[model samples]
Target: MTMKWKGWALATGALAFSATAMAAPPSAEMISFACAGCHGTNGGSAGLTMPSLASQSKTAIVDAMKKFKSGERPSTVMGRLAKGYTDADFDAMATFFSKQKFHPTTQAVNAAKVKKGEALQEANCSRCHLEDGKEGKDDTPVMASQWLPYLQMQMDLYQSGARKMPEKMAEKVKPLSKEDLDALLHFYASVK
Candidate 1:
């Protein structure tokens, strides 16, 4: 092809790429004022009931918001709040939080608890959560750096039917002893 023709084609491609990038949605900070009280500025929550959004998958975050807004996933607090969010707000929030790194905590974990948790995780949880519990695929959220209290609360919820989970997950965790549950929570929470 002629040099002039090639130059024109390159220029056209660059312009199209720039336009697409510029059209991409803004970050969560634009709409986070509504969520900051419970979810914190970076998606880490002080409340045990609130799950951290740092490093969470964008699709998962968006889906959860949809569920909350629809009343399919029941949350007294989130349901009411989510109802007020637009699709654009949800997308921007998800995109923003997904890009943030998790804040590491300095909480001390019991050595014995950590050891037992590691063993229990390897035996029962590793298949799904993998070695770090952060290497998730698809809908699974990263659990490696999750808060201990939140982990425990979720397990209890799953066991008691508070958190509606899939049949497979419910079935797998149905037989866990109290100690096993404690160990699993400790192991996951201790991971950096």
Candidate 2:
């Protein structure tokens, strides 16, 4: 090849390489790591209130992220975080979390709490959350495996009207006294 033609070919090849690199999507590990700052590595959070995302259903993750992005769901940090991602990004993150195994942790294991909470859950929250609090195999998120502090915080948000909740969920939450909420959190955490 002529020197001039060779130079042009090299330039073209370089450009193609760069473009190819740019076109590739971020690995699921990389994407999940970005969330690990708060969500913990592999979605197993050690924080008192952060929820574990590992092994959660994809639909649940996608829906929550979409709600945060659209401002339909009330959140402090999540809305801003969700706004930064596209639907496709959310899907990828959800899929990543869904594949990882959930590592459940707990602090309080009062039998009384578990017993009372079970009764309360059966009466009011069983429809969507299911009897196991795993949220069934549906679009709804899991509860039994969530952090107790986080669960309590979310419950408080609903009860105090600080955060918006689904109408049906809010209605069920309305009847829960402070004690009931505590017991419920305890029960769920123990099962996890």
lDDT of each: 0.73, 0.80
Tens digit per residue, CA lDDT, model 1, 138-176 = 566777767787777777766776668766666666788
Kindly report the root-mean-square deviation of model 1 from the true structure over all alpha carbons. Answer: 7.5
lDDT of 1 at 24: 39
Candidate 2's TM-score reads 0.80
Local lDDT at 178 for model 2: 86
Give the best candidate by lDDT: 2
TM agreement with the true structure for every prediction: 0.74, 0.80
Model 1, residue 145: distance off in Å is 2.7
Displacement of residue 182 (Cα, Å) in model 1 is 1.5
User: Which digits, one per residue and each the tens of the lDDT, describe model 2 over residues 1-192?
Assistant: 356855675777864655554444787776778998898888888898888888788998998898888887778899999988888889899999988876678575789988998988888888888756764356767787687778888877777777678788878877788899898888888776
Q: Where is the poorest 10-residue window by lDDT in model 2?
A: 15-24
Which candidate tops TM-score? 2
Model 1, residue 102: C-alpha shift (Å): 2.5
